[model samples]
Target chain A: MKPFTQHSGIAAALLVDNIDTDQIIPSREMKRVSKLGLGEGLFAGWRYVYDGAERAGENAEFVLNDPVFRNATILLGGANFGCGSSREHAVWALADFGIRAVIASSFGRIFRNNCARNGLLAVELAAEHVDRIAAQGAEPVDIDLEACRLTLGDGTTIDFDVPPADRDMLIRGLDYIDFALRYADDIDAFVTRDRRSRPWAHLRASES
Target chain B: MARTLFDKIWDRHVVRQLDDQSLLVYVDRVFLHERTGSVALTALEEEGRRVRNPQHVFATMDHILDTFPGRGDRTLVPGGEAFVKTMRRTANDVGIRLFDIHDGRHGITHLISAEQGITVPGLVVACPDSHTCTLGALGAIGWGIGTSDCEHVLATETLRAVKPGQLRVTFDGALGPGVTAKDMIVHLIARYTAAGARGFAMEYAGPAVEALDMDARFTLCNMAVEFSAFTGLIAPDATTLEYVRGRPYAPQGPDFEQAERNWSELRSDDDAEFDLEYRIDCSDIQPTVTWGTSPEHAVGIDGRVPDPETAGDHDAGRAMQLALDYMGLEPGQPLKTLPIDGAFIGSCTNARLSDLRAAAGILRGRRVARGVRAICTPGSQVVKQTAEAEGIDEVFLAAGFEWREPGCSLCFNAGGEGFAPEERVISSTNRNFRGRQGPRVRTHLASPAMVAAAAVSGAIADSREFAETGTNGQDAA
Candidate 1:
């Protein structure tokens, strides 16, 4: 994971509400077992014209395909963005496509967690603020994770909130598993007490 | 202290606090499917990490596996076999149990988890599939996670997660005829919007929920993700205990009795307060179906397509117009009588034996209308064998519907088999996202009986009209 202290880049606006993970990267495009090479498949359903599964050409109507916004590194979206599926590929696809951050009113719980783990900044801002930023078109926006603020192209700034733990993880490029391992003794104590109190809940090796 | 059920579970699972909002929570069980499991396991191996508790982890080959008769590793999605092969090899190398294609227990991750008694009350279950919330029907804390989280759980048997607030959604009164759990959940999402329960762990309560059997409860909780909830749960009752008693991995004899007593105490206290509360009258809910891409675009079966002009707010109206354009539907067009090209009854949402039996009840003496392609894929090998023994397969076959092997067939086009482009399909699956079934395909989410009714009529018809005089034939159990 790349540490994310700050980033400044062009932002594209896709203001449709409930922009689910399927639209971000359709299941059919996830044919590869690996995560690499998904950048081309990001938003495949809308970014490209399809003739029975073959990408016949780019759908120039899509915001991402617009020449002015083709290099956008930040995404401005509507409420409940990435609202379906637990596919980490959606976040990976966005990161691979050069998107460093996403600003939305709300997000799917798992998708937000995926973004945190992958160092893709998921900022929750008011819908009005997000809409205001989207109105800036392809202009560059700056995000300061350390300061918890987003600066629009017009020099106006809006405060955003990322959960404290997720913000710490992103700024430090830390793996949560490694962080969790630090409390090994606490985990072991809980397991020992839980096993005695609720033996049936713990599956034995023989059961497997 | 009158703690809610969610609070009790969260407190019990907390190994330590990671931050002001996050806790290091112990995971009791982890379930995986080939689609994302292979990637997570391979990544873990590359990191030189081993599963801390392989016995508590279970994997299956479902997401990308072919459901054709005599199917093997071959799949419709290009390069899909690699996923299955990698999952099988990785599960073996990691020493975790793998329900391969030939395994008699092979099925969708959520279904088999419950069927095998791998998800018990008060346990924390994690999976890589969004519908993992289905396990919450048994009073468990089950939520979907990304591959990185999957790897974290596999390596440490614990997860760092922010504790969610609690929401209690109570369904009062009884569900009317032709109204199933699928309708109830879809109705909730449609009325409250997809993100109604966002950032919350939801609990289903009240008389209507208590009346539902285990299968129906599973159906109700299966769509928690669609509502953007961390998970949805019901208090474990006699129905849940009875369902778990005889399952293969369930506790035995004295242990079973003890477990039952503990599970019986898993409900929220009488005075427990939730962060949010919603009370819905079940009688007001009709057999529902999605008319557009998102599940939130659902309406009663007898309702008409909503006009974008009345959709409220410019953004919502624009979204509705786009959905209408994609669906090729008119604003005031009635949902009923709209012709359909295909009908499907399967997926984790409604493919258990009970779901198949409900569809078979509707198809017993009826034939799928001409030009309508209908199919039924049982949820598991055990469900398939049981349905066959009960003659449910004959009903589907005689009705001109294809009886297929058990797997997630045509549920998201990952298996490479789906309805043609622009083909309208009435399905019992959970999602109706754009191109979810196939390129340019249109999908309407409904219950099993509703799908069967559409198959027989070759159109979107009110299932109540076809119900037998005294019964709706929609109850799973």
Candidate 2:
């Protein structure tokens, strides 16, 4: 996962609310054995012709295909982005597409966490603020994780909030597994106590 | 202390709280499907981190398998066999329980988890599939995680998660006939938009929920993900205990009694506090169906399609307009009158034995309407066998519906069988996203009975009306 600190790039505005993981990367595209090379499969349902193949010709109506935003590294989206399914491929596709940041009013919990875990900055701002940023399509916007702010070229700055720990992990390029393992003692203590408290809850293979 | 049901279960599982306020919690059960599970297993294998507890981990080959009768270890999706074989080999090498193709226990992950007693109450269950929350009906805390998180859990029987705020949705009053848990959940999603329950662990309670059977409770919790909720739960009760008493994986005798004793105390205290509360009168809901791409675009069977232009502030107007446009539906059109090309009564959402019975009741004496291709895929081999024993399969087959084996069929047009582009389908599946069933395929999310009614009418017809008249639904149309 790449570390996030400060990034400035072209922003593409996709103002569709409830952009489910299914719509982002349909299940059909997730059949690949490896997670590599799913960037072309991103939004394949809406991104390409209905030929069941990738890059079959872009769907002209889709904003992602708009030549103006072809090099977009930031995505400005509507509320409740990534609402359905917990497919990490949704984030994989976004990252694979060269999108380093996504700004939305809100996001699905799993999708948001997946973004942070994978080093994609998922920024949540007020709906009004997001609308303002989304209106500036394909324009350069600067996102500073340490500053906790996004700056438009016209000197307009909007503050956003990310969990301090999430921001630290992103800034330090840390893995959750390592972070979690640091608290192994606590997990062990809890499990030890819980076994006595709820002995029947244990799944004994012998019972089956 | 008066702790909510979620707090009780969550506190029990907390391994420790990190500096970030997120808890590293022990997970009792982890179920995986081929679509995403294979990735996690392969990652774990590559990392050389063996599963911490193989008995606690269960893998099943769903999602990509063909639901066709006599199907072997083959799949319709190109290169899909690799996933099945990988899951098989990984489960074998790791000593995790695997429900392979042709295994009588093979089924959708969530369904089999409950049916096989893998998801007992007072435990935390995790899975890569979003609808893993379905097991919450058993009074378990079920969290849906991505493949990366799945890998983490496979290596260590715990996951680091931010504790969610609590929300309680209580359903009061009596449910009208033919109004199922599916209707109630769809109504809830429609009332509160898709993100209504965002960041909340929701508990379904009150008289209506308490009165529901175990299977119906699963239906309600299954759609909790549609609301963008972290998870959904219902405290275990006598009904739940009765349902799990003799399942193949459930405890027996003295151990079962001890489990019951623990589960009995798993409910939210009367004085428990919630961050939010919503109360719905069960009688207010009707046989519901989603008319647009998102689940929140639901309207009652008797209601007309909404005029997006009349939507209030916020993105309501634009969202509604987009949904209507993609659905190819006109404002003010009746939802029940629209013709359908396909009717699918299968998926993790509503493919249980009881769901099949509900659909069979409507399809008993009537054939699927002319030109309508209807398919009934049971949720598992166990469900299929049980339905067959009860003549439910004969009812469906005799009604001109294709009877298929269990997996996930026609739920989404991934690679195998599905409706053609522009074809309208009323499905019992959870999602109705644009092009989900096929390219340009218009899907209406509905209950099993509703899907059955549509199949018999070749159009969107109210299931309650068919239930009342016991008609084939063509006459109603």
Candidate 3:
């Protein structure tokens, strides 16, 4: 579980908000249990043709159809980005699309966390700021996780403040599991104490 | 500053306060879905442990498995089969009950929770999936959790957490013609800038909530996640109790009568604390549709896209740009003119019987677009059976749309049966994120009826045209 902040090779930008789990890789793509390469199917319709035109045309109507943004690294999106069902597929799709960071005005908490834990950055920007980045399409909006700044093509750098906890996550590239894993010793001690104090979990553990 | 149900529930859920800034909250139930649940189960295995309270955790196969086109897991699409298999094995290994693909009780998480009374008010519920907030419609504190979070909760039955401030969105007056809770919420998301419910537990209140039926109330709470709310809820009113009556796990008979008395006391006091409050008149809302990639990038069905020239700021300019490119709409163009390639009616959000009826009424005599792939999928298995029995399925099929089985079909992208990339789809499910369906499959969520209208016209069309097809759109109101 690599943290989203560590990855810089992939930059993802999406047009829609509230991207639910059903939409990410779709239930069809989850046939295998392993976390394999789901990137090819990332934004499948948009990256491909509109109803089978082969490669997306330059004048194609959809964002994924735009030629200039063929390999966009960062995703600039509208408000309530990643809204809807809690599907890690939404995050998987982004990460698979080579989109390491998704700079949006807002994110659905569940989808955003899945991205962070899966090494996909769900960077937050003010709606106003996100609008600017979206306007700069295919021009690459640099997200400096350390500095918490979103730099535009015109050299306009917008400061983004990362929450301390999330910042720690990015800096160390630790998802919640990895973050908790850091306190494995402490957790072990607590588990030992808790087992003795309550025994419900351990008792249940023994029986099940 | 009127108190909403969310603040009331949040205050009561607080248990021991730790020295560190976290709250040691108590969880009543934990729902484990297949995708992330498998990981959580494996982690527990690595730790040599079990679910803290197996009785409190419920497992279901909703996301990964394909139940669409009907029951046989073997017949399920490849992806759906794999998801179900992974989920089934994980749940069995953990001694958790699994609602495998064919189970009559199988469906979206929220619907199952309600049907089973697992979402009784005044309890804390967490699931690995986002729409878990749909249970919040019952006044429970519900939100989505990650696999590790699920793992922690499994071992400890509690997790370190911060509480959310409450946002009370009070809509007074009755909803008008063609507007259901889905439309009202979509309109609000469009108006409130999508992030309006951020950092808050959105409580739907006032005359609007009280007037809404159980299904409508569920629709409101279901989308709270759309606006970044931890969850949303309405107080357990007579309507709530009525909906839960006789549910499998609901308090029965005398127990139920007594439970109602307790439930009635769950409302917040008039002076309850709240972080924010917004008021709207129900009459002011209209049929809403997205002209761009984001849900917030929406306007009334008749409204035009926001002109970049008129965009208020630099950020607004960017939003306009992406919306224009992704939705294939020019700035200031009327979204109503944009064509659609498909229309889907299903998902946890709007896949109920009422949604189907509404959509069916509109499609009865209409012809689906020539090349559009239109389908109507019920949210639950029960809904499918009921709609079919009522001839609603016929209405849709007659309109040239596919009347699929119970599972979530185009609602999300689960079965991989969605429109081609850049092919616009009018969906009844929540969320329309980029590549949400079939990679570049573009989605516009509306009431089932609205999607039905789009299916007929092959573009974003209003459901009003179908008011006379089956029944009056305003008659329900």
Task: Say which candidate scores most in lDDT.
Answer: 1
Per-model TM-score versus the true fold: 0.98, 0.97, 0.80
Docking class of 1: high
Candidate 2 residue-wise lDDT, B190-221, digit = tens: 99888899779999999888888887889999
Q: Which candidate wins on DockQ?
A: 1
Q: Proportion of native contacts in model 1?
A: 0.82
- Deviating ranges (above 4 Å) for candidate 1: B468-477
lDDT of 1 by residue, B326-383 (tens): 9999989999999999999999999987788777777888999999999899989988
TM-score of chain A of 1: 0.97
Could you tell me the C-alpha RMSD of candidate 3 in Å?
5.8
Error of 2 at B425 (Å): 0.4
Model 2, residue B448: distance off in Å is 1.0
lDDT of 1 by residue, A1-208 (tens): 7999999998899887888999999888887888788888899999999778688999999998899999989998888999888999999999999999999888999999999999899998878898899888877899999999988888999988889999999999997788888888888899999999889888887788
> A110, model 1: CA deviation in Å?
0.6
Q: Residues A24-126, candidate 3: write the lDDT tens digits.
A: 5555455555555777655544444543524443336545545666566677775556666565656766667666677777776776756655666677776
Q: For each model, chain A TM-score?
A: 0.97, 0.94, 0.77
What is candidate 1's DockQ? 0.82
- Predictions ranked by lDDT, top down? 1, 2, 3
For model 1 chain B, give the 10-residue run with minimal summed lDDT: B468-477
Tens digits of lDDT, candidate 2, A13-51: 777788889888987787687777889889888788756
